[model samples]
Target chain A: MARIDLDHIRHSYLRNPVKDSDFALKEVHQSFDDGAAYALLGPSGCGKTSLLNIISGLLQPSRGRLLFDGEDVTALSPEQRNIAQVFQFPVIYDTMTVYDNSAFPLRNRGFSEVDVDRRVRETLEMIDLGDRANRKARGLTADQKQKISLGRGLVRSDVNAILFDEPLTVIDPHMKWVLRSQLKQLHKRFGYTMVYVTHDQTEALTFADTVVVMYEGEIVQIGTPSELFERPSHTFVGYFIGSPGMNLLPVELDGASARLGSRVIALPGAMKSAGAAKTELGIRPEYVRLGREGLPVAIRAVEDIGRHKIVRATLEGRELAAIVPEHGEIPAEPRVTFDPKGINIYADSWRQELVA
Target chain B: MERTRNNKARFLVLPVLLLVAFSAIIPLMTVVNYSVQDTFGNNVFFWAGLDWFDELLHSPRFWQALARNLVFSGIILAIEVPLGILIALNMPKAGWGVPACLVLMALPLLIPWNVVGMIWQVFGRVDIGLLGKTLSLLGIDYNYVQDPVDARITIIVMDVWHWTSLVVLLCYAGLVSIPDAYYRAAKIDGASRWSVFRYIQLPKMHRVLLIAVLLRFMDSFMIYTEPFVVTGGGPGNETTFLSIDLVKMAVGQFDLGPAAAMSLVYFLIVMLLSWVFYTVMTNYGRES
Candidate 1:
């Protein structure tokens, strides 16, 4: 419904942030396209919630301009900006029935009784709480209360954006899945500009069309799920995305070959040192090939995880993990090789494009 | 967990039972014994049966004191509860002002009961005190010692000044415990100031407010020290309460049987009122 633009936004809880480290959110300049589902993904204390709050206008940035649909709304409140946010915990008016709870936002915006009633009923049905329209919100379970929360946001279809701040945290696992799928369906049906903030990789990967990965107080990468898996822009992204995460190994680069310990391995592509002080090779565990060839590794353990086996090994004193298909043979002497497509080179922890 | 069925473990409570007998049971039993008998000088006693209770129940003086107690408690609750809630709502929620406001609200409650009575008694003197002299100069004839209305007003104001802080402190605690998300969500939902208070803040403060109401009710009903010191149940017993009347009956008149009977009735009244109130409030909360 609205394209949100963050122009060099920076925030700090302190009155006077003397240094950059004092800021909770470092300078960030990005624009989210209208009608696109984006997830702000990061670990705890990584400033994801701060960024979400900024978007919702619940928090004003210490510095920068926020534009909604090209209109500067930096000084506007959440109500003025017409933003709806679902918090980590379900918030409901304990005295109001589910129908009235969902109708609150609509009624606040001066909608007529006929319109409010129609929209509330439609949203309640969408959230699978249609039968509970007459029940007071106090005695509802966590998930049902969360659905009522979702219904309030959904009732008003013309809002600028709907934001979610770990809204499924109190829900059970099975309920989380149901609510997430319902949210996806709503997003697709309405084309709402949704920004979900979470530390969960699976949720971000599946729910978002574009995932914005953040670390410390800055965004590390913004890309699609496939793009992030194949081409990570920062070492943090590589370490944060996958199940076992990408294995990083220190290497010394020379011409087109990198030396690990006393052995030299041919690089898949050319390297540009550019006076770099540190270099490492990054690769996902799914692409790590273990066979009877290439560099020898000391296999420490093999864990059978149903569909596949995870080979835990030590290669040149560096720990590594490789996934093998079910029933795959583990050679008497195991050797590991990197898939050329999975190879990523980092210069000072920033991923560099390997020239083919 | 495995259940431990040790019969000998029950004997560990012997010390507590002995302590209770010394602290609560023995004194209550003595009062009961006095209530059922006629006592003379030098401990000469005779069986009175239910005669003391029947006489006290029929007396208009005893019924008037009970009515006065109920009226005082009702006025105190009506004034203090709303005033405390309003002050708490207006108080600053953060920064240096929080501690300052809390300490200021707590000052009235920290004074000794008799000291509060003494302070107000002197402070309301028509010739020498600031309030009384100022009221006299303003052409208002406010003589607490001579006028019953003025005397009752002084007692009620004194009680309000002393005890409203307990309510404010409890409600403030309740207000702070509410998570920040609820406010943020309310704002996003475009709730007006009145709606936010009615829906969010009031519901959150429900339990603490119940405690505040019950405590203020009981404390105001059993009030004795301050009013007793200020009015001495004077101005024709205008400020006399149940506790004050019972004290006068036992200590001033030395009528042990009638005083003990009155004490038993007063205890039952307080218990019955508190229980009924708690049950009604809790049941109302549970229904929705």
Candidate 2:
């Protein structure tokens, strides 16, 4: 295992990329420590796969250096770097048996037959394919084939890291959950540095110790699951992570508070310099308090989704959503209030910290 | 729930069945009818009871032609399959080179078979043709019309030039359909080039290679047009395949009984060989 570091990596598919928009992956500088689980989370075309490929040495960044355990490996191939990668689709040797498929890497590296057999049997048991060791890989189901692919990665004991690029996309829902838990267990048992790339929030939040949220080819926020939920550093992160995402309202900054249209709300800290064009107050829908004595809101619709209710309302000509309990009271005249601790002040699409 | 079995929709297949009967079954029945009978003249027929089959099976000329057919097919397959795969592997994977290579590879398959034969016939003339003149200038005795070995070589080269593109095209189609992930995984696994070909490429190309082999086999086995135009079964009948010999018996000598019997035997040989090839290959695919 190794601590992988990316030093200002950037990539562009075009020959002469002068504009910032020409790059597929903009400047990214991050470090993944040894024996930690990381998830690169983003929407489609947000450079998550590109970042994963760069880490695995399948692709070289056009502009930066990559270091593995403080050794420069930017020019090395995937084999020379000792990396393993699983693709979106299952890739196994269809003509080989399950044992041979898992033992391919070991045999290719010139291991002895006894060693290859022992390692392959252990991996097959780990993947729950011990009884299918003699079966041809072509006859297996999709999930079973993917497990063989995972087994191929696990059979090698000298790999620096194992990367997965949405490997469970083709699996059924139940199998996806099962394989995910198995992967987590494997990570814990082996302590191999792993990087998983996905667009699903649940998969990212549940699988990784650090969740890196990305938007428009840039890393917007990197934090734990709860940190991402409570204090998103960017409006895009707040909008992308949760179900009924954060409610962003335009505001004008005062001395130690912010004014939304005509009403004023207490701020966590005084704004140092609010000279930006767009200033807004960001709060999650779960923190929007509904009562009878706060700012008046024109309720548009309310939807009951089993455990909770989503209250869609209009405040100052802008739509906002609030999550209310199923048994919570909705008065004839509804009013809303912002929790003091839940309010986040943004100057220009970036979060400002409290100075107290 | 049980599906409704309707008998009214069964009549929709009558038109296709009649078309097959008129086009294929009638001519086949005529051959079978003539194979077991004799005719002297004026629509007079007599039941000969397999006399023609007994005569042709014992004939040395028929056995020699069948041997020639087998050797030709074996040599063609041995040379063309590997050569086509080599050319396909060297072709560019992407960019403008793909279309350029495809067009160049498809050029030979566009020409008619007899026309290809005529081109080679002139091309092997010692006095005027480029290939023959070059061989003559190199102090080599090269006369296809006079030497049996030269005649066979010329015919084999002509067939290869005319049909190897078909194999290349089929193999190229199979090669391109392999996803890039397989190559990436192989690279990560540190596989050698030979292992990559053995484990990944050859298995992927198995189905198309079967088609190419069966096609080249049938075409070379029933070879009539090109070699007839080029060699004309000359030099003591060294190049006379089964179809050429059957045609010589039916059209040149006007022996209907034996010719019909030879045609049926030739058709059966082709059908039996094709079945053996298909069964062996598909079973191999399933087992491994």
Candidate 3:
């Protein structure tokens, strides 16, 4: 295991990268602790895969220091970095048997036949593909082939880190869940430094110990799943991490209170400064209460999702989603209230710290 | 309504079947008829009852020509497949260069086969051709017209130049179809360049390679125009493949009975070999 550090990493395809927009990956400076399961979560083209590629030495950053275990490794190749990666689609040798596919890296590195067999067998058992060991990979289904790809990465124990780039996209929903659980178990058992990239919030939250939410070529926040859900550092994070996502309402700040349209809502603490340009109040759907009290809302639609009902309504002429329990009643005159602790104030799309 | 719809669908296949019958079945029937009979100059014919086939089977010329055809096809396949793959691998993956490279590759394939032979015939001459002059300047004696070895080498090289681009284009299509995720996966696995080529690129290119091999083999086996143009089946039959021999017997010599028999045998050989190639490759693909 190794603590991988990225110090001021930035990359651009063009020869002269002058401005922020020119870069595929904006400046990122962070460290992943040894044995930590980290996720680089973002929508497509948000530089998550680029960051992962940089770490794996498939790409070199234009300007940055990549340190592995406090030693400079920016110039190292992927082989030198010792990283295992499973792709979005399976990348197995179709002509080779499952056993050979899984044992490829060990054999390439000149491991003894006994050692190769032992490791390959253990990985096959771990992936529950032991019975198909002798079968050629070309005949396997997509999911099974992907498992072989995963097994190939996992068979080598000497690797410093394992990276997964949305490796379950092709898997069926039920199989995806099963594989996700299996991956989680394998991570627990092995304690290898793992970095997974995914656009799916559920996969990111479920797989990683620390979820690194990215937006537009930059890392917005890196925190535990609960921290991200409860206190998102950026409005994008708040909007991205939830199913219906968080509602950001334009607001005028006044010290410990903010006015949303015609109503004044009390803030938990004082705002340090009203920031430039865009100012809004962000809150998750779960934290927004809907009843016969508080600010008036014009209900547009109600979605009954079995366990909970999501009320889609217009608040001060802006659409907002609020979650209510299945048994909760809808009032004839519907109103909403934001939990003071759950409310977050954003200025210029950045979170503003609250002053006690 | 159901009966009418079924009748309409059955009618749809009639024209296609008729087209196949006219184009393929008719020629095949003619060849079969010729193979079984002998004809004199005044349009009078006699049933030979496989005598021509027996003669062809026992002839040393037939065996030698078949051997030459096999060797030529084998050589062409050996040179083309890997060379094509290498060129495709080295070409620019993206940008303005891609279309330019594609156009350059397609130029040779667009030229007529006889024209290609004429171009090489002129290009390989000792007096006016740049290649001959350059070879002479480099202190080498090279003459396709007078030397059998030189004729064979020139023909093989000419075929490679003309047809290898097709293989390259096919392999390039296969290469470009590979998603970026596969390369990323290979990098993460710390796969060496050779491993990546072996495990990912080669397996993904299996379907294209099979097509290339089949096309190159059939074309090389049936090659007659280019060698006939350059060497004229010449320098004492050293470069005379089966097609050249068959053409000489049928057209130059006008021995229709033996020629028809040879054509049938030749057609059977190509059909049997093609079927064998297709069956073996497809079955291997399935088993893998």
Q: Can you write out model 1's per-residue Cα lDDT over B98-152, one digit (the tens) per residue?
A: 9999999999998999999999998899999888999999999999999999999
- Residues B116-176 of candidate 3: C-alpha lDDT, one tens digit per residue: 9999998988888888778978889999988888998999999999999999999999999
| TM-score computed on alpha carbons, candidate 2 | 0.96
B87: Cα error in model 2, Å = 1.5
Tell me, by DockQ, which candidate is best. Answer: 1
lDDT of each: 0.91, 0.91, 0.89
The candidate with the higher lDDT, 2 or 3, is: 2
lDDT of 1 by residue, A1-356 (tens): 89999999999999999799999999999999999999999999999999999999899999999999999999999989988889999999998999999999888789999999899988988888999999999989999998888788888878889899998898999988988998999899889999999999999998999999999999999999998998988889998999789999999887677788976767788775567899988989998999999999999999998999999999999999999999898999999888888988899999987775
- What are the RMSD figures for all models against the true structure? 1.6, 2.1, 2.4
Tens digits of per-residue lDDT, candidate 2, B1-288, equal 999988988899999999999999999999999889888768899998899999999999999999999999999999999999989888999999999999999999999888998899989999999999999999999999999999999998998999899999999999999999899999888899998898989999999999999999998899999999998998779888888888888899888899999999999999999999989999999888
Which candidate has the top score in TM-score? 1
- Per-residue CA lDDT of model 3 for A1-356, tens digit only, reads 78899999999988999988999999999999889899999999999999998998988999989999999999998877877888888887778899998988888778999999999999999989999999988888888988898897788887788888898999999989988988899889888899999999999999999999999999999999999998888999999999899899999888888888888988998778654688889989999999978989999999999999999999989999999999999999999988888899899888888887
Query: Model 3: clashing residue pairs?
Result: none
Model 2: colliding residue pairs:
none
Model 3 spans > 4 angstroms off: B1-5, B132-141
lDDT of 2 by residue, A1-356 (tens): 88999999998888888899998999999999899999999999999999998888888888899999999999998888888898899999999999999999999999999999999999998889999999999999889999988888889987889999998899999999999999899999999899999999999999999999988888999999999999999998888888888999999887778888888878878877757899889999899999897888999999999899999999878898999999999889999998878888887999887654
Please report the TM-score between candidate 3 and the true structure.
0.93
